[model samples]
Target: MSMMKTILAAVAGAATALALAAAPAQAAPTAPHVRGTSTVPAYSYENAIRESVWVQTTLDGDLDGVPDKVAVDLVRPRETAAAHQRVPVVMEASPYYACCGRGNEGELKEYDANGTIAKEPLFYDNYFVPRGYAFVAVDLPGTNRSTGCEDVGGRNEVLGAKAVVDWLNGRARATYADGSAAVATRWTNGKVGMIGKSWDGSIANGVAATGVEGLETIVPIAGISSWYDYTRFNGVIRSPGYATFLSEYVSSRPEACTANLAELATGSGDDTGDLNAFWAERNYRPKASRVKASVFVVHGVNDTNVTTSQFAHWWSALRTPKKIWLAQQGHVDPFDFRRAAWVETLHRWFDFYLQGLRNGIDRAPQASVETAPGTWVDQRTWPAAGTRPVRVGLGNGDGVTGTLGGSSGNAKRTWTDNPDLFEAEATATPNTPVPGRVAFLSAPLRRDLRLSGIPTATLKVKVDRPTTELTARLVDYGTAARVNYQGPEEGITTLGTESCWGSSTAADDACYLDTAEDVVTDDHAVLTRGWQDAAHHVSLRFRTPLTPGRWYTIDVPLQATDQIVRTGHVLGLILQQSDNEYSTPSTMGATLSLDLAGSSLTLPVASGSLPPAGATAPQVKTAPAPATSSLRRPDLRQLP
Candidate 1:
């Protein structure tokens, strides 16, 4: 370990010197568009892709008594040349209603205070378009030079999407990416698809509810499914990370950059504010009834801003054919890859649905990621076949056990919610603080446990006070202390009592501003761009997995780990109560309890016996006296 550290330091020093030497040389400028790329032509009609700015007007559907405006950048393939060709369209609805007013110059501002615009960093230009598709990024009503009040979750945005589709279907283009002449209106293959990262992801789901005529597919990444649970997790009002972004952060930008800021600032906080549902209707997945588009959802498993559980609800409820991609990276991190590998998968997914392409993408597993434990597992369905829900009891100070079907009696555990974990900050790395939670271990595995899909916990828990925060993380105990990738974490909290957005110019410059008077810092401030939410006393299921050899622990007596916990390397069941520097801002001071007898970790026990202690995938099991709820099986269950 010492030698490895020394080598790493030397390597870092050399890299720094090399960067300094090359700093003076000016690099050629890249294209100025979201997802702009340098290697390919900005617009390519030959491969069925082009880029152009578009404009449209908003309608008063609910007869809100006032009209609105909207505008978008439209990118797609040539029309006349490709008839009956259905292609997917990726669209980004502005984060704030005021976002679309002025355009961001794709600036890279300072990390902390250096002075870079906090715009969503572009990965490559029209990269997805040339991959054979169309893309649309639009400003919401009353924002970014667009017209209308900031009717946030209300119907205006969805209506705006329908208007854009209508405009696209009727228009005729003058040329293609190949420099060939053509009519803009001829490009209508009569199919539309939507994809976006972060807030745009939320609007993706919102507009999908409209059931627009040409709409076909939606890909929402790292966006919340519920507004209530999103801003407030586990009954505690958390720092409005996403809200701070639009209300305060984007609101402060120059008007020419994002037009709606002025209007967003103009609205009344009590009711007229477009940021809440009072103005715009909230968009959610149609009641498993009105949904029309096939959906493909993605969320970062380790995302600090948007927890993994946000996508789980939609995945379970959506009526259309849907597939979910759970990446282990951060929000929008998947776009970091310049190559089309990851982007191609997205294209193929849309191709299968929109174009009826007989690609294998549809047959791919319901879940997949590149760096996980094993190759993808293809199942006829998700939540797997014939699996029953198991309830496990949590024990005091990291002791975990419970019964799946057998009549295991009741058990309980106690824990202290240490507020100090709220102090230690986290960085994206192999080693960092895994906070607030506790861990329990099972003896060496006897057989390969292939637990794919979601796992959850149900605990009759009690906090030290009336309000508390609880986060459940399930991990597979791996060989050499490697924890297999579990799905996203489920954050639960009480509602209404949670935080609300507040901002003031007199406040610190670093605070994200929602308005001159009310700012939504990592503290209070909320928005309903439209996602799902969770109420209290809910037994939540996580949609990720736990691999073999790793320990699985559920943190019920949840606390906050603000500081880093660097213990010796051992596979761990990381429990976190609060979102510290590494997470969304959370308040402190709370105690929690878990009824251990009611909570348990479920594993897909393959047919085999438990293996020896040091062996990677143990192939053996032994029947020991059932003293505690936590059990170690020595023999694998035989296949039916």
Candidate 2:
């Protein structure tokens, strides 16, 4: 039997003796204990009572000399306070307590009249709290109950969270609003696991990167590790209003972080999209080598808000123990797709790592990859260990037929790079006669082709201007119906009815309104997209402007993904200048002169076989690709 089974079997007898945290007064069982340490019962759930307090951090974000206090709401097994049992902690430090909300319900933290948090968002407390873990919902400094200025992922933001882990380990101080000592985390064993989604999850990454003691593990779902990559891609401004808007959104008042906001504006380098000390300070990926805790990462393959590369590059750099889940949804919570299974796996993970239960989670597969909306398979390693790079050439006079080993000498096509055109508009059809786009399609596939890992396009090209914004999209084009993984909506449908998880109380509930899965008829799906600044082709930090009419060979790495193109499907590569959703449109246009002799797209193929010599491949049905219908620009591009 595995170590997990051995440990679980060894403690099976005591599991029945453990009492439920939320049980009525008539309950007679005691809390579960193992090896002199507290452990959650495998059969029963919810042995904890809800509580609240304010914790002081070392950083005075507002420069007020007195450090700011973050609100911490707790729920843990009540029996721990009765005896020597001390439980582990699961923390989610968030800046979205007042705005945006958490999970599918958009549930905000509700506050009592006295300013203490009356209820927290999500089912973390409802589920895990009952499972012998203390759940801490912290309001980040400068947001909600926490006092200070919002730093927007600056030094203050990272330091503020680190202070919490210090306090939990008995290295820092915490007090109440009345200047009295707050209740200690006396019930905890000082081992903590942090988890959250998006910005909340980013904090978890930042704190874990500090190598802070007591942070045993972290689960960062759809989180950003490098803020620069969040707003800029390869020195091109991918999105605007990231710094100023996010800081303002979390602050209760505009003036609360006015100076801080100004500092973000000047330092973000939005105008130039260059790397500086400002972006370096906000970078969590660079500190990944310093991370000490085990990490469990979850991200959607089709996520556009934070993007997939953010997770891909970070996962590649992590040296410590790690696991990943790549889902098929777009910017969504994993629970919405696979709630029960996710909860069960998470339970086993925390139980093993933090509680030292030895559930054999470490022996489980390191990665889970989605093959479809409702289908997934375990992988021995993320990005699937090894794959050969196959070079597919852009051939045919018009370069519309995507083929491999067919070198068309000096086959050049020119398109005026129109800044106003959207990517969806550029990739409207396989033979789209767009004025501002050039597209290439491979011959109808002879057999099923599985593409995994990052795709790169090495182009021998020249431009009429000194600099230009470039975009490459590896698209799947065919008549076969598939998941609508195109931007900007990513094919999600909101629903009317709501679903609830765990148990509900008068103050806090896990119930949330539901959103129906988005399953749309799709002719072609944008598989992976990449952006670049022509000037930054040589180096991201240094700009090397191209001479007009100069041939410059540049390799653009497309977004990383795992997708299967069924037999009879054709692969397409679309070259365009701008995407309104991904970045601000350039004011000027440029002419791209392509030289196909030395230019080809390199793809990492995980599986598929080449056709026999002279064998006629089957014809693939073609449909007019959806431009306005599917790949329309999103409202998020137009930041308010």
lDDT (CA) per prediction: 0.42, 0.75
Candidate 2 per-residue lDDT, tens place, 1-640, comes to: 6999989976874665554534566844454544233344432223356556667777777766787777777777676667756788899998887877887667888866775555778888776765677788887888877788767677777777787788788877777657677545676788999999888788888998899999999999988888777777777876576788778877875666677788888988776667788988888888999899999999888777788887888888899889999887777777776677787888788888887877688989999988766679998987776767887776643354334335566678777877657755666655646677777766667888877788998888899988787789987777554555553445455567777666556778767666545666667778888888888899877678889999998888877888877787777788887666677643348888878777888988888843421111223344644555465555553211
- Flag regions of model 2 displaced more than 4 Å: 1-49, 183-185, 397-405, 485-500, 513-516, 585-587, 609-633, 636-640
Backbone clash pairs for candidate 2 read 20-47, 21-46, 21-47, 21-48, 46-130, 48-76, 400-441, 401-441, 402-441, 402-442
Best model number under TM-score: 2
Of the candidates shown, which would achieve the greatest lDDT relative to the real structure? Answer: 2
- Looking at candidate 1, what is the lDDT of residue 349? 73
